[model samples]
Structure formats: C-alpha cells, structure tokens
Target: MKKEFMKNSLYVMIIICVIGFIIIFSSGAIGKSMQYNYLQKYENAVPSNQLERYLNDITSNFRTAGQVISTLGGFGILLCGYAHYKEL
Candidate 1:
C-alpha cells in the first residue's frame, strides 16, 4: 500500500510538471508572476544575503528544467521509433 501511494504521488508530480512545463514553455503569465514575486521577495531582504542566493538557486532549477524538457522530447521521439520498429 505504501508503494502504491508513492506511485500515485509520483504520477501526480509528473502531471503537475507537465502542466508547469507547458505553461512555462509558452512563456506565459505564470512565469511572469513567479519571476516578479521572486524579485519582490529578494528586494525586500537585505542585499547580498542568503535569501537572495536561495531565490537564484530556485530560478536556476527552473532553467535546468527547461533543458530537461528538450532532453525528454528527444527521448520520447526515440521511444516512438523503437515502438514502430518492434511492430514490424
């Protein structure tokens, strides 16, 4: 039962990521709001502090995720080819 719960949570995470990826991929308002919010929070704190650094780290993770989308997209294409090749 614990394994099943973990599987469901993972599925939910993947779906959420896909939705976030789509929204961010389009360069939409969600991305804008997130950026703005981060900027505001960073500015409210003291300059050259840990909070600012942490926010930068979070944004970098988002950028890394964009890179992953491309990697996954290519892998998905390769999977399609393999499926087709096996069908013959």
Candidate 2:
C-alpha cells in the first residue's frame, strides 16, 4: 500500500511538472500580449519611458515566475525519478 501510494504520488508530481512546463512555454507569449494591451490602454496617460519600464518590469516578473515554476517542476521530477529508481 505504501509503495502504491508513493508511485501514485510520483505520477501526480509528473503531471504537475508537465503543467509547469506548459506554463513556462506559454507565459512568454502571454506576457507579450498583455504588455501590448496594457501599453495601448495607457498610451497617453503615461509617459513612454515610464510605461516601457513598467511593461518591462511586468514581463520580467512573468518570466521570473515561469523560471521558478520550471525549476520546482524539474526538481520534483528529478526527485521522483530518483525515488523510483531506488525502489527498483
């Protein structure tokens, strides 16, 4: 029963990792589109330099989030793989 639980947990971790991978792949384009929309919405209200900086910061934050997610997923997958190997 414990072994079955462990195996199931590992499978769940793998699925989460795949979801993280998908987020990492999609975030960039999503960020770009969001940034563009934000800029367009505030075209005249904000100065170009300030708006650009803000948009850059937003994009950077999104990228950082993606990186962190990817790192966690990678680590989780690696740990599960090691556990599986050791079990065998």
Candidate 3:
C-alpha cells in the first residue's frame, strides 16, 4: 500500500511539473510578463501598469505556491520510495 501510494505520488508530481513548465513558457511574447515575481519584477518592468502589476502579483503568488507544493510532492515521493527501498 505504501509502495502504491508513493507510485501515484510520483506520477502526480510529474504531471504538476509539466503544468508548471507550461505556465513558465506559454506567454504570448517571448518577453511578455504574466507574473510579477520578486525576481521577475526587475526583469519585466516594461509593462508597468496597474492591471499588469495585479496580474503579475497574483500569478506570482499562485505559481510560487504551486511550485512549493510540487516540490513537496516530489520530496514526498522520493522519501517514500527510499523508505520502501530500505525495507527491501
């Protein structure tokens, strides 16, 4: 049961990683800004409007949260696999 749960967790993490990649790449323009992340703030300063700022802030927060959850999911899968491995 633990083995099966970890296996499913790995697959879910992989799918989330793919979705994150899509968000990080699917902007309309090569340099278009959709998220005003702390790192992104200085880089994507061209679109300095209220709407863009709001969009950036919101997306940045959500994306960052998504990334954190994805990372946790990955770690969880790895730890579970390692535990199962040790039991073998």
Top lDDT: which candidate number? 2
Q: Rate the local accuracy (lDDT) of all candidates.
A: 0.57, 0.75, 0.60
Q: Which stretches of candidate 3 lie over 4 Å from their true place?
A: 1-48
**Could you estimate the TM-score for every candidate?**
0.42, 0.70, 0.50
RMSD of each: 8.1, 2.4, 7.7
Instruction: Please give the RMSD of candidate 2 to the true structure.
Output: 2.4
The residue-level lDDT of candidate 2 at 17 comes to: 70
Q: For residues 20-69, what per-residue lDDT tens digits would candidate 2 score against the true structure?
A: 67766776676778777877787757677876676677767776777777
**Number of clashing residue pairs in every model?**
0, 0, 1
Ranking of predictions according to TM-score: 2, 3, 1
lDDT of 2 at 20: 68
Winner on TM-score between 2 and 3 is: 2
The lDDT-based order of candidates, best leading, equals: 2, 3, 1
Pairs with backbone N, CA or C atoms under 3 Å apart (clashes), candidate 2:
none
- State the lDDT of candidate 3 residue by residue for 4-60, as single tens digits: 876787687677766655554443332234443433666645544754666656666
Model 1: lDDT to the true structure: 0.57
- Cα error, residue 3 of model 3, in Å, equals 5.8
What does the lDDT come to for candidate 2?
Answer: 0.75
